[model samples]
Target: MSEVPGPSKRFSTDNSSFSGAKKPRKTVLDSCTSDENDCSSEEAVYSQCNDGRMDGPFGEIPDHLLINTIETPSVSLLRSSAITPTVSEQSFILPSHIGVAGYSSISALPSFDDNNRQVAQNIDDQPSHEGATATWASTGSMKTLDFTKAQELLVPVPSDPLEAFLLFLNNDILDLIVRETNLNAERVLQQPGVTDKYRITNWKELTREECMTFLGLLLHTGTIRLNRLNDYWKTHWLFNIPSFRQYMSRNRFMLILRCLHFSSDPRDEDRLTEIRPIVDNFNTVMNNIYSPGKQLTLDESMVLWRGRLLFRQYIKNKRHKYGVKFYVLAEPEGIVLKFQIYGGAHEETSGQGHTQKIVLKLLEDNLDSGHSVYMDNFYNSYDLAVKLLDRQTYCTGTLRKNREGNPVDLSTVTLKKGEYKSVFLNNVHIGKWRDKRYVLYISTEHDNEMMEVTNKRGQVLLKPSAIVHYDNFMSGVDLQDQMLSYYPCERKTMRWYKKLFIHVLQMSVANAYYLYNKFSTKQRLNLYDFRLSILEKLLPKKTDQLKVLKVEHKLTKIENVKLREKKERRGIRTIKEIVRKECKGCKQIKKRVATLYECKGCDGSPGFCTQCFCNFHS
Candidate 1:
């Protein structure tokens, strides 16, 4: 193999001009002075052999290419490889390894043919390649830099509403629901019903589609009051035109009654364990279905349930004084991006305080730069603000007066009604104002400024931008709650977990409606109309109406006798038997007809002479 040159050889700058007549000289070489291992590499050295040939790892370097340099040999060799042919007149080889600045690879160099000498001369006249090697020499440290770390952040949006909606209610969840329903149905049928006539029997297992349609009907039906599913199934009243059985049979509906969770072990401590997969699976789907916008809000939403449960909560101020509480993060359009069920103190997260921890957990996947979050006083704190700010996120919310790290000046400052003041400190802005009451707000995004606002009476007033934006944006979760409550599928259930399942089901439907409006090609539909459409699709095909009977032709002799027998069983006399048909004869008056019955055979008819019948009988 040909040997590469060592470091001692040097090319003199005095002979700057290249001449074909002069024998090609050895490349310049400098000994490795530093202890760094970079200098010991093959490309680092150029030396002369006994035959006067320059050799190192690089066998034969041309003399015209050698530039006299007193600097490090290794860096110069790498920088030399980055040079490109100026005019593209001919082709030359460049090392596959080294890069040009941050560009991936070097372009092809010009070949040294007589036909390309003019092209090379023209290229040398141009200034584009000036100090190209020097630039690369200065950037030696950047060769190992990872370009992938600078990737742009991307958020996903769903193109199809139906597809996105069905993701949360996947086959796995439906299968589990079916299995649990069967288990409960078996248990229910084994026990007697409220009445002997109403005892359940031969309950069949529900198919996945049937169960889904049943849910759709429940959502579409609004509210109903009936003694049993059989009543809804069989009732033929005008008001119940499309009977509940049109969507799902009574037996199938009864199989899943009050049974969302199933456990093989009857004595399992956590009855909710069986249905926990649903919660996890649904949350995952919803999280990945659509990415939230830059603005988000965090607050608590209640799933109404007045039941005896270990995690059941009661908030006096809420419309529902008793229910399960869920901490939710939502977009301004009332879409729930993420949520966590509060299972008492045991549900505590690993972080600061409960409220701050909940806020952090809700905003975990949404901590991108410039993303703004709004919340109530329960979650706003200085520590949370700082932490979010560090992650390049901005947070704004109402702040409690007693919170730690609040500005002392904010607390001491007193203002009259309709007056406000604000202070900026450490990227956090604190605003204080008094209207009917004192309001304090903390934010990282807003400045201490007020904007003119027109009230309902058309009176103009000045409101702080922070307060205005907070009011407008902080209601995301509240808006979601309101939307959910409008066509709510919540039913009174003693089983807390079942109520939760129902709550999530309603949420999924509402979300689907929202997404449909967002992406649908047809006219947008409201929540009620959307649910009705889904119900229509899910319901069984309508059959032809049965023929009706006329009143006069409906009752024949046999039918009349049957009606009489039915009525007589309760001690009621029939009209046909009550009318007197014959009369018995009186004394002197000629042929007097008795108004009462004289004989059994003659009195059976409606018209008969009592005197004639009595005389004839005698």
Candidate 2:
């Protein structure tokens, strides 16, 4: 048995490059010191080894290629064998791996020859099953799918990010929120054994404008992170955001956050009942506003939530491995086209495989338009490619070679780096290429051709066109996930649906920004600046010192003694300005009641509601 020299042994600049004995663990390519080489023999070795490789992707073939290839779909699939190495192959071994540096090993070539032979014949002769089976053609042209759908914006795209965002969160949605919020507050106050802070007199009905301001504060807090919500309204100038103190009182903000309800229905049977309003409304407006372009991508994304959830998923590869999972379909550049929540196994699929159902459902409206979808191996299959073609959609992605309907001999034919094997029948093309490792792909579009691409190091390289196109279009969901992750509005909460609701709001913000860029002709704004613009627009009419926190106003012993002696001159009076605050009188007895009037001749200008004031002053 001949030894296969590891990577380092085959490319050593030192001519006595037979250092295989010295470096026991290193590969043939590792021993080479330089990133480049002028080795002529190595070039000949690559050319000789990579002969008759497939050109692009799926190509022309007869209909019989995909027949069960066996008796049952559930039957044990064939495992392609290690191609018996030829005499010349055994002799001409270069352990060094090819990289983007343009085949740098400068070494003498060992003698070998299989130039006149066809690898397709070898692939065909090797039987994967007992019966005669299909095999790769080794050489063929591909038919890459062109993205033909140029979408028109369904509505006039707004130039302002805030207006674009408002298209989804319009007056109707805001009004519903206001009504429910107010109703829920009243209901909470009426509950048995309710605390004094939540009493009917202490609760003020929330207005639509106030709701917008509340959301603005939430969005702003997402960007300027702090340890606690109270920190934003702190009295100290060093840490306080004056706008927070002036626009909304701290207790009021907490009140809104606590009682922020989307639906009035108190049913626990439907887990999604609480947040269904926002999710349903946002999903509708998202697709109605803008149409996506030719290329699309489908994948799952996770929202970072480690708390208790009925349907939370743990995906080891995801950035937020433990969270609620969402199946997302989006354009290649990060615009969310459609999304569905994974509510559990019951809601996962209708009647098909999980992959097929998700892809079909997400593309339900976008299909039959000649658009191409790029996916990873998890969702790629020969069955899926064929199913998509039936709907006039082209599917391109890496496939699991062992998946049912794959060619019998593909595994049998081993490929070195830069080499590929492919067989086609009609529109479906299945192929495996060797790069850093083995890669299997199935595609309905994309012809067999090499594409010139540049690496980050600015080096030019040639890759299969299918591989290049897949790399270009497959990160849509990931990109959307990345943008949403930038300024997440979600916070710690006991309700999983609330966190989910906040996450959907964050998605709307992202979609709004994408729309702003897509339509507005003027100076484009980044996400942070765009969100800032929206926040400013959504802020309620400002007031002069609504809830000023006087942290240093703690009384000394003398002041504390005087605080008990309320003079007759101090009186309950209505101030010209209408502001909501915790009543000073209510606070005296450890209660929290909102007041609309202020007390005259008071040291701190504390507020007092009608009933609470007369009770305190009397």
- Each model's TM-score, in the order given? 0.60, 0.66
For model 2, the stretches where C-alpha displacement exceeds 4 angstroms are: 1-148, 197-201, 264-270, 348-352, 540-618
1-618: candidate 1 lDDT, tens digit per residue: 234444443433454444555443333232333343223443433433334444233344444333334322233323321222243312222345632222212211223444323123232121222122112110111011111212121233334544545667778777877777777766766775444454355455677877777776666545454434455665334235445655566665654564445444453444356456666776787666665567778888888776577778888877787888888888778887788887765444733367777887777776754578888888886667767777778888898876655554566788999998776544667678898999999887877678888889999989888888888888877787787777655556436766677778778877777766775566787776776666666564555422221112111111121223335656866454333322323423355443433343322332335444444444
Clashes of each: 12, 24
- lDDT (Cα, tens digit) per residue for candidate 2, span 399-451: 87555456666767888898887777546777778889998887888766778
- Count backbone clashes in candidate 2: 24
- lDDT, model 1, position 135: 22
RMSD of each: 24.9, 18.1
